[model samples]
Target: MEASTSERPAAAEGGVAPMVRFDRVTKRYGALTVLDDLQLDIAAGEKVAIIGPSGSGKTTVLRMLMTLERIDGGVIWVDGEPMTHMPGPGAAGSGSLVPASQRHLRQVRGKVGMVFQHFNLFPHMSALKNCMEAPVTVLGLSRKEARERGAELLSMVGLGDKLDHFPGQLSGGQQQRVAIARALAMRPKVMLFDEVTSALDPELVGEVLTVIRKLGAEHDLTMIMVTHQMGFAKEFADRVCFFYQGRIAETGAPAELFGNPENERTRQFLSAVLEAG
Candidate 1:
């Protein structure tokens, strides 16, 4: 499909704007394209789950939003501002998708945080220090204030006692929880979970999912999770998107998509996943 940029959708009847939008976005590695002219909009405070077989571009979607990967074409808008590009000088909303400057990117990225499958914690730092580092260094919080905030977040994820523990001393699940707390310390408006439990032992998966469930239920943050855990997705997500070969093949409420998938590919995929489980 050819890439095309388009205007943002009008606000909902309630006048609430969408928090994120992908307008005819595309990604490619040489001749092999991953995302093809995709379009998706996520409202503020919405919980969305992206699920599909490996290499279906589910993870790529999150990576793109976090600015880890650059788009080959089209634009991405965050909080109604261009993310993949900046407005031209004196053009005032009339510019093309030129590359965003580092300053612009950093400003836009402050509102987003991501948790990876592998616990990417610093081995040398204690849980408290790990959580406190970014907010102190990047967000400019004082050492005392960052420490207090980090302690509270660690406690929220059931790690109040593990504050002084190093990543080497913690189990995979505990380490992942620390990672989540670290992300939360940034006070991001949007959170991305990319197969967060995929690297954990089968028994430890539930612990991490439980914390995520709590976040979804209690916090007003917009969440987009790319997970293979269909049951959890159905339970926690307000909307579920199924991707196939980089395009959104099907999307709807969890109950409808998981219970009675309208697309044949979705049906086949669900059947395969269910049987594997």
Candidate 2:
């Protein structure tokens, strides 16, 4: 059966606890190295913005955290549990030689929610149905319970009236909002946003951002966002990280990084993006 919100396990809470930690992670796709040895720690309820030029592995960070992409080396820990750990080939742990078990991955994935650039809503379903599908299927929620929960989530995202609308009937911004609601339905501990507003119309960006801003304030979610919206990054993030050449180039508070960047690469990047904006 699908786990109820009350029964769902959340990530670590309280002060100074590392909700998510990436320890010396590295990922490579053949000759192309996507992520270098990287280490990052996100405290409970912290909102972190990952800003970088295109191809700087911003999205990869989110994907890796979600376990959508496997790490080539090192480990990830969530809520004090190892995310990608298993016994070695000839070692004994968790009963068997499998490095990573599907069951473990499912548990890990359930705690992490990811919102993609394009709202990947099911074309055949209405907003309500789209939101309820995973809960009912993967989590074993009854359709009625899922419907109620889904409606509540849709309403929370300012789409309560649009539950019956299909993706084709909604604007890009509305669709993305629904996507956010769908991810929220999982009651995830960590929410990963990958250029969430990048695909929206310029005028439609604010609504999506407002919804996110509210989420940041209202929930104790560990959020790691990959975004190009410099203004939003400055206002929403507790700390801003600049990635260059598949590594973190600079990281600091919004004021320190945006007002007085220590890295020359970060300075150049902000200059280019500011000019473009």
Best model per TM-score? 1
Give one digit per residue, the lDDT tens place, for model 2 in 1-277: 1111111123445535588888677888888998898888888788999999999998999998888888787677777666776444554433222335777878877889989999889999999999999999999999999999999999999999999999999999999999999999988999999999999999999999999999998999989999999999999999999999999999999999999999999999999999999
Query: Candidate 2 has which clashing residue pairs, if any?
Result: 2-139, 2-140
Quantify all predictions' global Cα lDDT against the true fold: 0.91, 0.86
Q: What stretches of model 1 exceed 4 Å from their correct place? A: 1-9, 95-97
List, residue by residue over 94-148, the lDDT tens digit for candidate 1.
5434578889999999889999999899999999999999999999999999999
